[model samples]
Target: MQQQAPKAYIIVSNDKNEIQKTSAYTAKTLSSIIKTCLGPRAMQKMVLTKINSIEMSNDGNSILREMDVNHPSARCLIELSRTQDEECGDGTTSVLIFASELLNQIVPHLKTLHPIKVCNILRKAKDICINHLNTIAMEAAESDLINIVTSSVATKLCCVLKLPIPELALRSVQLIKSSIDGRIDVKNDIKIEKILGNFDECEIIEGIILEKEIIHSQMRRSIENPKILILDMPLEYRKGESVTNMEFSNKNDFTRALEIEEEQIHKMCGYIVDTGADIVITEKGISDLALSILYEKQITAIRRIKKSDSNRISKATGATVLNRLEDASPKHLGEAGMFEYVKIGKEYFCKLSKCKNPKAISVILRGPTRDVLTEIERNFMDAVKVARNVLLNPKLVPGGGASEMSMALKLNNSNDKEEKIIFRECGVALKVIPSILSTNSGNGICLDVINELEKKQNKDGPYFGINGITGEISDMKNIVLEPLVVKTQCIKSGFEAVMQILRVDGIIESKSK
Candidate 1:
């Protein structure tokens, strides 16, 4: 019998050409996967997770997040989108698109030029393009902020819900900005609460809203100018340790023990009542006996509240969270102008409002269904982030690819020939934004629209691009605007990702036995 050749247990390939080919293919493939999910007219991708749940979204970061790709290059691109979202929060899709196109642009030139040379050229081009973008960027005014928010929200929401959503988002961001003492942190300060209801009924509350009800049925549901008490300790009777045991010789002995427990709980409730707290919120449980005492005193008690919610309530109402009943005092109490138990959907929520100084606020997001509400929340979050970015940076760029196209044109016109070739490719890569926008519009005149945009920018001197909705060339200055930080991050992050992918030289695989 012929000797059978042993199967290759491990394979290693250091072929530079094959590795570069793989990287390019992976980047382009990943790009094409989300290409249709780019613009206002983009298509939505329905991702079915391993746990068998479905997520339908057009947001690039969301789509890539749910994908379970094993390819290294694909993961890098996905991580790039995540980083963009974390840093800028609004240009996740644009960064990925630009990065892929940049790779696509420079891949062909790799055979003629060194990878390090290409990387350096692209790096220099990125800096120059960004500086040019900065020169063209205009400062954002108060009204212009709403426009920027509207532009971002308009892409994800329907026309009917567009107008009000941005208003709510900007208002929430402003509330967070104004309330904070030193720093403005939108992510932690703003709380988004979603309830199933009419979408048009969405509103922002000036204080926290907890999805919890009063512990006792007889407790008051509404109070005016209530003093609040927040607790970190349990109001229930303490339990004996596992190592300790108690034996009762008679049933009356056990009854005496129960009475002592009730008396202890009553004394704890008396501490709160003495503090003149109209409402009590605890991070731990409250026993039935304690609830009865609070109810008799007409105090509304919310038990088992989340720690984060308790902290926010403290911030909103100027209350101090106490770990012991002995530490309760009038000075430790917080005051709210109004406290009410509101029934939303099939559940009851505790609403605290009209605080004198509230550093945290709740945005109530309502929709006809869970999926709709989820999508709205996702889109609203991006809008909030966009508003925050603008408030922090206060700079604006013409949206709908005008800024990108202008950067592309300027990058191409650089004086040095060697640098000119690199800039030309970079410029062409930047044009992918408008080209994809045109393609997704289904106008069937992508090339025509691109040429028209270039002509308009060349003639009108920037601030001219295709209107994503109408698929026609228009003055983007009056039509739409995006934050300068978002655009700047897109080019910087995209180029970095392309450089990472292009620098890969080989892959070594070892199969497990």
Candidate 2:
């Protein structure tokens, strides 16, 4: 009995064929879920989360994130959307669609060939497609940014916005770009606020907007050419870091302590007032004594502002945030041409605008409801990100599946039958984008649209693509354009995700007692 040892159990959960089928099935299922959410005619999904939160969106990434999937292949597809979003900020849906179609094309080959062979062929095809894409890319001019951004926003719900969203996005990017004299940071420089109203009221401001009101009612509600002072430290008296007991000799001692606190607050307020600042904004709290002093000096004060908001205020107004009252200086004060306290709906917002060289701005979005506003914000953000990509890369590609069709056609042109056979599947996968676009374009005949695009693409080159709106083959040079980097990243991300699932040969699980 002592010599007989227990045998270990090695459970083979799935073989190679079974694993590939499972992964392919998972990819197809997820892709089917997001395929209808591809183009302008795409339908939205109403997802109910575990916590009973309902999200209605056509965004592939958002929908996938709300889904609770335990399968490894499904997770890979979801992660592919996330990677596409993070890398290019657009094409989240397109990437997943491409991956699913690619997996479908190769699953047949996987039955006869090794997974490594398929992966090698896919890797080679992906590189070739990207190089071809680079050759087909056009240099993006300033005027082209509108088309690029418009193309990105057209597929979202915000396309119904009455305002010129593309121009607003470009203007915001340009405003920040001109002020910084360097590369643009869209997330940090541009702020989006969603308010309940009609879309006509949407506006883009040249400076940041504070969703806060004046701390003191007696303070000025508006100021002209105001000098702003930003503070990181509290204007109230300092308190001990830890609790300590103080034994007062009499009631007079307690009164004297209060007097000292008031004196400290007065000293702090005196420093701010001496700087001739028309507005005081602090990341930390301000005491009543300091508020009264600031109001008495005809200064507007907003306290308990978020640190990020304070930084934005400082950037917009050209002010340096100070932590100490003694360090206040006129040179450190920020200047703005106008400051107004306005009431919108039930909340009051402070707007600072007309800066000499503002580095930050806000886009106020007015929608019919919160959910609609949220979708609009998401769409607008994607537009902003597309604009940023164009600005940073300064390269464009024809949108509406033109690039994909062109690459697919080029990939298919081979003399050797073997090369054609191997790469043709890759080409077919690339064609999935245009196919899905055509299917979602409200066209009854998807195959006919794809056939027309293929013929036109072969003759007219890569600029020929299916018009997502009308499902007609048209030139996408002026109508729709995408950031070249986004298209490249989509192909690369999709290939990587497909290979990740395809290379998995088997699953092993140990039995738990």
Q: Which candidate is the best by lDDT?
A: 1
Candidate 2 residue lDDT tens string, 1-513: 346545555434445577778788888899999999987678889988677977788888888988999877888789889877766678999998898988888887766778887787778888989999899899987767786787787767767555567777878887888534667877788888888987888888878888997878879998999999999998888899999788899979999988998988888888988999999998999888888888889989998988888878887899999998798999999999899999876678999988877788888988888877877777777778787888888888888889998888878767765557768998888888888889888875988888888888777688988788888888998578888899999998888888888888765544433
Ten contiguous residues minimizing lDDT sum, candidate 2: 5-14
Put down candidate 1 lDDT per residue, 1-513, tens digits, no spaces: 676655443333665456667777787887898888776777778888677877778888988888887778888999999988877778888888888888877888877788898888888888888999899999998878887888876667543355387888888877777533545677777778989988777888888999987768778988999999999999999787577777999979989998898888888888898999999999999888888888888888899988888888987888999998998999999988899999988888999998876888888888888877888888888888888899989999998899999999888767887778888888889999999988887775898889988988888888988788788888888988899999999888998888888887765554433
* Whole-model lDDT values for every prediction: 0.84, 0.83
lDDT of 2 at 374: 77
Stretches of candidate 1 exceeding 4 Å from the true structure: 1-14, 158-163, 178-182, 239-242, 245-263, 413-417, 509-512
RMSD of each: 4.0, 3.7
